[model samples]
Target: MSTPQPQTHQQAAPAPNWQSAPGTSYTSPIPITRTHLGHALTSEWTKIKSVRSTMWTLGVFLLLVVGIGLLVAANTDSNDYADVPYTIPAFFGLILGQICLITLGVLVVSSEYGTGMIRTTFTASPQRHRVLTAKLLIFFVVAFVVSAFAIGFVGLITSGMHGGASDNKWGGTVLMGALYVSLLGVLALAVGSMLRHSAGAITAMLGLVLVPAILPAFLMMSESLRTLGEKMTEYNAPNALAKIFELDSENGGGGSQLVLLVGVTAAAIAGAYALLERRDV
Candidate 1:
């Protein structure tokens, strides 16, 4: 009677759990993989170029960079090189180029907060640290390109102004100048993250980039302070970054890594990363 009642369906059994080796560290969640990092970088780059502000900032930077070089070229008389060390004044663009870099840099992260898109960003990509790394990567890439463009145009325009053959020295300056300008964005982005406010980050950036630039000019007024500050601006500090591209001075007191440069860059980035990942959006 039981055999004739009906055949019952049998279900598959659940899989067994495997245990890990004892005393080994266990991280339930792994970091984002390289593939994810690449995807995030691509996404970030797309986001950067799609914005109108990016275009506007880029346009303005190019204009200022090119404009300053031409102005310096036009103003250069024999007197320009009479007392100063370098023959070409094109490197002068470094000063003006920084403004554009700072503005764009702030917008990079602050813009996200402004539009309330940060939540959307994080929601889509929960691996928050990877997002930051992507932003950093994209910023550097953009900076490198913008720099090449600015330097290339300046060189072409000032070709006849400087008699010194466009040798490796000039090449080095151009490259370094571009890097310093671009890295400013990284610093700005960090501050933007930490303060989570554009105004605060921008103000801090001004304090860092602007103060160091003008300090050298003021130091000239007082011999003792000038000597000490000159040591700071010209070489003994983070201003040495400029030297990598040959922006250092003839007297060896011209430009070293401006102390603020390294400190600002490091502090801003770390603080930003911590605040960004640890806190709620």
Candidate 2:
């Protein structure tokens, strides 16, 4: 006969405080949530506002747009606005101010690539398209709002001093001008993303903006290209802005300008997205 088997005591398992969902083996102690575009937007907003370039560029932009506008308004008389909208003076200021916005837009994406911060950005947010979308949205909104405010403020002052014509659609015209400027900035952003370099993208955008306006002049010298040159002059950025502000005599071209800009921006954005996915950060 064998010695009495050693006795063992077994403890009962604790009861579950909460039942796990079907097929879930564990529950996370920390809250788990899916990320969305809103999160990307918040991140982009934080990055953009924290950067010094954004502040500096926008400050110079405001100064140029507002200061030049005031100077032009101060020098002109009520008779100057008799046929044009009170918002016309804003066009002159915005002509120079747009350069600042375009620079800022290029810097938004290119700066990250310059500093290797884009890798970290992508690591934190794996969705590349979302990041690009956020950049586009943030840059567009800031540019549009600032442009509109500066231009609108100038229009208000000029209108107050010179008395706008009763037929002038001051609000609509000013908004349209702001929209055109914002589109230019957005296009610059797309170029920045595609090129991934600040200087190159800035130069390219400057050329795009100024070249069309000037190249058309030279192209007009050749009888063969005079038609194409005329079309370029009609649709170039400066001409578009002038028309939007009612400074140009042309009518019904505003829609065409908007369509052209919108189409170009869209194509640039699409190309940027395609490159961003394929290129190494």
TM-score of each: 0.72, 0.89
Model 1: residues with Cα > 4 Å off, grouped in runs: 1-35, 77-87, 160-168, 213-228, 231-248, 251-263
Candidates in order have lDDT scores of: 0.70, 0.90
Q: What count of clashes does model 1 give?
A: 12
Q: What is the lDDT of candidate 2?
A: 0.90
Error of 2 at 156 (Å): 0.7
Candidate 1 C-alpha lDDT tens digits along 221-253: 887787767655664223554454344455443
lDDT by residue for model 2 (221-242), tens? 9999999999999998888888
Model 1 residue 78 distance off true place after TM-score fit, in angstroms: 8.5
Evaluated with TM-score, which candidate comes out highest?
A: 2
lDDT for residue 231 in candidate 1, whole number 0-100: 59
Clash counts for all predictions: 12, 0
